[model samples]
Target: MTFQSTTSGIWIPLITPFKAGELDESSLRRLVKHYSSIGLRGFVLAATTGEGQTLDDAELERLASVCADETSHCSCEMPIYLGVSGSDPRKVEKRFQQTKHWPIDGYLISGPNYLRPSQDGVKRHYEFLAGSTERPIMIYNIPYRTGVNVLNETMLELAALPNIVGLKDCCGSPEQSYDLLRCAPKDFSVLTGEDPFFYNAMVHGAKGAILTGAHVLAHVHLEICEDLHNGHQKLALEKWNRVVHIPRLLFVEPSPAPVKHWLWRQGLIDSPEVRLPMLPIGDSLAGKIDAAVNLQGGTDWRI
Candidate 1:
């Protein structure tokens, strides 16, 4: 699909569920079904929120397959985008080759992490990958996590590529984001990856967001987007007021831990299990999440 048509709205960076130290296919399917029913525009499987680094290649394949299969059964088929990131150009290219036939609509690839390449190298990195894959690519420019930022000039250059459709803008610089938004091609989308900045980004003309916090109270996020799209700035801000603390609360610890705990409390997943090097939520935070859920009236919150 072209980026112009499919890149907007709230896309959930899914959390991979684990049971007994194995991929929890059942819970994965359930989470997809629940979100699909609530009207999420797309899914980003095995992304950072899903603990992509912790998953082996085969596990990533399974995660993609389960999401694709389940989403197909939804009343509205939501697009699925698989997340792939690394510092090695060859290895990253091989990832595209490996998952080339997987059931997915596109790819969410991040800037090279750790080794922090120059802006020119980063541009070449995506140029090489874009040449390697026929699928549309959403450039993920998360400097905080990847240790390098895709400067506005580099981003505009990458946006010119036919296959490089949009961006998951986490560059962490409002000035850079504004410059790109002002100059990016009309067809090239710029979706914010920073959860706390979702509403702010929308006001600044972000197409949408790939939010980890949207895993809970997703419809509220969707409504905020709709209000903005319809020019209901007042209504959107009012809606945002109700859930602005979500991202802050969810990220109070390390990510998916707090999110998974919230999902477990809502019984959306069987267990709040994360892989090694990532643990479950703490008791204090769990209590806060519980209080949040209670205040929102749990899963019965109006969609």
Candidate 2:
């Protein structure tokens, strides 16, 4: 399927589940089934939320294939997008070529991290990768993480490429986001990666979001998008006000830690175990997540 068709809606950046220090295939399958049943438009496997950096190529490919198979069997047949990143253009290109046979619909490729390449270099890097893949590519512009931002001018230039279909806009600059939203081609989608800014971004013309926080209260986030699409401005703002604290709570201890804890509590996964360098949520945050879930009317509070 084309990227434009999958760009506009709530896309979950799935968390990698581990059991006894290995990929939890059962939990991963169950998670995909649950989310796909809930009206999610697509899935982004092994992204930052999925701990892509910590996973080996084989693990990443396995994760993608599992998600793709599960999604295809679901009632919705959701598209699965893989997340890939690297500092060396040659290595990144080669990796993409090697993984070309993986069962995925597209890729969410981030800019090089640490190297902090110039705009021209960033453009060249993306262009070279785009040239290597037949599948659609979504530019992941999270400057805070990558240490380099894909400026609006560079974004527009990339948008002109036939296969560079959209962006996961976590640039962290409202000015840059708004400019790209206004100037990007209609087919060049702009989906927010910032959970806190999901509502605001959609209101300002972002097609959708790839929020990690949605792993808990997903329907509430999906409803926010639905409300805006149906032109319920007042209702959308009200919903946004009610659930805006979710992102803060989820990020209180750094990503999927808090999210994984919540999912485990909901009986969606077996354990909340994350890899080394990333710890599980603490007791205090666990209480907060519990209270948050309760306040939202418990697990039954879904659309």
Clashes of each: 0, 0
TM-score list, all predictions: 0.96, 0.96
Off by over 4 Å in 1: 300-303
Candidate 1, run of 10 with poorest lDDT: 294-303
Which residue pairs overlap in candidate 2's backbone?
none
| Candidate 1 Cα deviation (angstroms), residue 193 | 0.7
Global lDDT of each candidate: 0.88, 0.87
lDDT of 2: 0.87
Total clashing pairs in model 1: 0
Pairs that clash in candidate 1:
none
